[model samples]
Target: MKLSHKLYPFQNSDPTRKSLGDIIILHGLFGSSKNWVTVARFLSNFGSVYTVDQRNHGDSPHSEEHSIRLMSEDLEEFIFDHKIQNPVLLGHSMGGLVAMYFDLTHPGILKKLIIQDIAPRSYPFAYDKEIQSMSFALDGFTSRTEIDSEMAKYVTDSFIRQFLQMSLDRNEDGTYRWKLNVDGLNHARRVFDDVFTFEKTSETPTLFLLGGESEYIRDSDFGVMDHFFKNNHKIKIAGGGHYIHFTHQTEYLEILNQELSFHS
Candidate 1:
């Protein structure tokens, strides 16, 4: 599958400046490349930044099948198709899981790996309510407010409701429809809770960015992280939650730039 992407070319035009190679960013579930526009623009100063929409999300083609392995394969194809070399692969939440799987299966393909706010272990929580909300909204709403109202019943967080609303697409008749493949994602809900396992530890340099307010990465998960990534570094954003990049943009970017500079 050829994933859809938005590229931000290097901003600096000075010939004397050095290139930091490619930086590929993958968005989380129900997210599109648009979510990372600000980050991509900032990272563009270092290298060409490619914000990709994983399968079933954003402008990417939909599939009945969705899993970490399949998404990893899609990333592989996207990387090869665009001839991206030694890209600094970065992923957030669900996308981070895909990045880890890709590194585990196809080792040495990336310059460095960055996993944001997600651990290698399975999540206990399910997205049933969120899926239901999306399904209800897909029936077509007269206005974005009505959609938000309907989503609020399932998703309590205003920020998350607003985030999910970003995936809305207005139809010809002016009714709003979701851009994501809702049914496909609903079917694969269990996959999200599936644990990631590997026989051999990966040597690729990895950085794990944790959110202090988020329960996604627990203290116990550090052992799993160490077992998988032998050359891994962990950093925590004190005030950030699961969406650290959005909540702590300045701090997140500063840490990301510092880490990327180490390899550059």
Candidate 2:
């Protein structure tokens, strides 16, 4: 029950022509609006676009509370504040799950809904070790080399290490701290239980895009996903992982264009 404190950071894209419409894109867990810059620029051709950095990620304010419901309501408030009429809403992974909860609670405002690489089910997460591992890496930050070396010990994946390193904020006093509230995320584990739970179907026209290589969405959850997102479309990006929008930008843009055309 905290203030909606202008939490997320966002970028607005100018359209090439008269704006076709408006769309808001939300990034996945540990991601920020910066990650979607390319996609935002590409999608801006079809409409004015908004890419947001959700709470605890990117440049957003770190709150003591983090939950899908809280984040969804924040989005709803943003839509109303901006007077964004029937804007297309797209979210990836954790953001996708937040989008689903938002639609379920507040329907009819969206022109269309797009969810990527997640389903309407509670996903089991064991991110504590990974998060602590990052903190553990920050034990002694004499230099970036020391930090990187410690991070390498905890996080073996070079790509993830590079991606997560973006969250580090440097102090004038020659110290480094994480931009994200890792402890808040640890406390938010309870919110996971409330990620996806409802019976009534949503009327918002929806598209579910997934990376074929991502294990986030299971075969069993497809039926539940269809149950809620009754008016929906589904696509799988071959050889793509969780970050389909980044890896398959062209294909992702084409699919988005097609959806825009269909809605138009």
Scored by lDDT, the top model is 1
The segments of candidate 2 whose C-alpha lies over 4 angstroms from its true place after superposition are 1-17, 137-143
Model 1, residue 14: C-alpha shift (Å)? 5.4
Residue pairs that clash (backbone atoms under 3 angstroms), model 2: none
Alpha-carbon RMSD, each predicted model? 1.5, 3.4
Candidate 1's residue-wise lDDT over 1-264, tens digit each? 988899999877677767789999999998999899999998887899999999999999999999888999899899889999989999999999999989988888889999999888787537788787888734646788988888889899899888887888898988777889989998886666664754867999999999987878778989999989999989999977999899899999999889876766
Model 2: worst 10 consecutive residues (lDDT sum): 1-10
Over 104-184, each residue of candidate 2 has an lDDT whose tens digit, in order, gives 888787878899998888876657645765666454577877887777777787777776777777888888888777777
**lDDT of each structure?**
0.87, 0.76
Candidate 2: C-alpha RMSD to true structure equals: 3.4
Clashes of 2: 0
